[model samples]
Target: MQQQAPKAYIIVSNDKNEIQKTSAYTAKTLSSIIKTCLGPRAMQKMVLTKINSIEMSNDGNSILREMDVNHPSARCLIELSRTQDEECGDGTTSVLIFASELLNQIVPHLKTLHPIKVCNILRKAKDICINHLNTIAMEAAESDLINIVTSSVATKLCCVLKLPIPELALRSVQLIKSSIDGRIDVKNDIKIEKILGNFDECEIIEGIILEKEIIHSQMRRSIENPKILILDMPLEYRKGESVTNMEFSNKNDFTRALEIEEEQIHKMCGYIVDTGADIVITEKGISDLALSILYEKQITAIRRIKKSDSNRISKATGATVLNRLEDASPKHLGEAGMFEYVKIGKEYFCKLSKCKNPKAISVILRGPTRDVLTEIERNFMDAVKVARNVLLNPKLVPGGGASEMSMALKLNNSNDKEEKIIFRECGVALKVIPSILSTNSGNGICLDVINELEKKQNKDGPYFGINGITGEISDMKNIVLEPLVVKTQCIKSGFEAVMQILRVDGIIESKSK
Candidate 1:
């Protein structure tokens, strides 16, 4: 019999030797990478790319996505931050810090405690933390919510993408606060566009604008009280899927075939003109022949808009997208108050206005460079997302680590003997966030600040926390605020990810034959 070869594997099976070798190392590794991006004073990292370009970002996901991480356990923590960003849009780094600290506490206890027991204890502690968080949450004032958005934007852009953006975020939240169905749906209702100009020139348009230009220069540039038509099918003759070859015996047959195609195009144009539509926006191309007729009839025709733009046009103008030319009936036609074309520099924008109670709106952003514009767009997205979440939850939490300190104080003082260690550990774990905030802010005596803040939370109230700037504890509720959903989601997502990493003992890799 041939001797069996040894199977290569890593053992982390809740045992001391493996726990330190595998799980603890992963928690420490991931936390070290993302902890620098936690608070307002967190330092920005300059990521050197493969192409030798340098990019700077303080966003947790943006920084994590650029990292060179290979450990499986470390990757699970990355997923935790990603989920937090998707669900809460902010506080991603806080989630990672909380999870890492929780894992750090559980390592020594793994000798006597079963992984399942720890998980159960964490679940209970999470509920306790969440309850305390809700208790401290306050009704959001409109100004407070605006501050939340602005603060989040400032963190992402270092106060460079400020000014009208914060104000724009405020107005946008109000406009998209309540959907027709009375639910939070700002992501769908908002549209963004980038054009060439100064950032100061950017403004919100109450209606949709197509990037497409007029196909015929002879067509009228402005039409008032315009009837808008949205078309999905081509405004020209298209051959069917099956291939067919026609043999023309003489020149007349070929000429007649050409006539037939032109006649079809003309018929399509005539149908559009008969409908009294001032503008025809199509998802497919419009033949030159059709354009000629439409131009002669003084109708504005824009060809080949994206499907997403087409849908918005329908919502704004109430136009039904037709599958066939025959569907262009009065009942199918949509109306808008005004339709016109505007030229900015060399670009043409199809601007629509006076759509009664238009639901979709676009905020055009401009910058001097492509990179500047790209960063501006991302910053705006983060701001808008926070605002939308506030509308949905309608609860505000004190920022500057106030909520964490308060929750930590609450969970540590719990009297449950059975899970006392777990609860206290979770409470202690919460302190790492504020500590990291102080350290990242360049405070060498950061631990002293955390102790002072925790003491203040106990004496003064849950609202007092250290200001990252001055290292002095203050009323965070009055000075700093954040959406309540971000804090709750960080806890909910962080605990689940920590459990998943802890439960893993051995990493088995198989080799293919």
Candidate 2:
């Protein structure tokens, strides 16, 4: 017998059931892969890259970016998650989960109303949800922010950052906070570097780490109150761009030529030292002779530093990277309280410490395996980003799905004021969060537990959500909480994604030209 033809793509075409099934399958398809990476009990996904490399990560954003998702709806959800990760850092999974659930609920209602009408109603309901988020969110202290980050990191399916992650994250915020109105610039200020070692060994250094070694062994490995100079030129003989040939009539001429070159090298070193720069960072090579000369002068010189690193030093130390040494002066040098070469594993890193004020800092991550460290770094970033977002907004909301359930309770119970067409389904769909949390944690979602959360919706309970691990209703704020922005953005982005996909009436395929 021959293989039967495919089942005629029941939901792939345009219809009410089509929208519902396709959206549900797409959402479920995407969520099923990473939902296990949800709470503290989440699991890691070992994804195979196109190059045949295996990546074990629990980061939702990472998985979303790397996964081979083909459906338009799925890609929309993935992009929504990316925005969440970019703007907020954490909660990518939450946004996608909420979108999938919300779309899944809207699928059945497609038969009752036109997509345009449904979308219009959703926009209004979204405003209501956002207001609810802002109303319920409370201002949090620094300690509460740390707790939120720790809670987020601990639930990472890849590598739960134990203690070092939270400790280092808080320190990073503090260090990054030292600049400009004491605000943390997550993208620009905080930098992350990964190393091979135990994850627990990871720590946040107070300053930036440049992956460079001294140009000469004779140079001191440590310097205090180091004045730093950034150079973009080579100290070697300036062989003009075009080659030059010369004939010496006698050996004296050759000797004089060699002496002149040595004199130039010495003169360059003198000018550098004259600037009172204890550390000279060059973008180009430093000749052996120049290195020896600098070593004798007790100046710590690092050569062949990448352009990016040089710029970071400039930003961190207020040093100007001069193209010509003749332009150098005391004013051009940057000040660092301390500078030292730190040995981690087999590599030596230049550590810049003790700046009066630094606009940039670095976060160093260590792990036993490269694969594990890769994921750990991603999770570390997720935590760091969330921490930074909290600082910008500093408003906290109960996590563990309490916020969504509360939103649903209010919307579902709304009486007489607004139409129930679109808002009603969203209210019903909001429970997807806690329900999934309960199911993912291996606990059967008890209706009574959900009902209890809804029943207490009217009361002043900031801690109302299911304990995903135990399937019990408890104070979720103590175990897990999130930034108000994270909650608000999730709802806004999730519903908007659903509307975009739902409004697609059909896929028009043109004949290949």
User: Tens digits of per-residue lDDT for model 1 on 1-513?
Assistant: 676676666544644438544666777777888788777776777877666666677778777766777677777878887887778778877888888888888767777787888888888888888999999999987667777887776666626555567678667666645456655556676778877787678787767876767889889888888888899989888776898899999979999999999988888887888888888899999888888888888888898898888887776667899988976776667777777788754588888877766666678888877666766776777777787787777798888888988988888765767488887888788888878877867755987888888788888899987677666777987678888888899988888887877777767765432
- The residue pairs found clashing in candidate 1 are 12-505
**Residue 271 miss distance in model 2 (angstroms):** 2.2
Model 2 steric clash total: 2
How much is the lDDT of residue 483 in candidate 1? 85
Model 2, position 178: C-alpha lDDT score? 49
Once superposed on the true structure, which residue ranges of model 2 sit more than 4 Å away at CA? Answer: 1-21, 157-161, 239-266, 413-418, 459-463, 508-513
lDDT of model 2, residue 54: 89
TM-score of every model versus the real structure: 0.91, 0.87
TM-score for model 2?
0.87
- Cα shift from native, residue 337, model 2 (Å): 3.4
Report RMSD (Å) for each prediction in the order shown.
3.5, 5.2
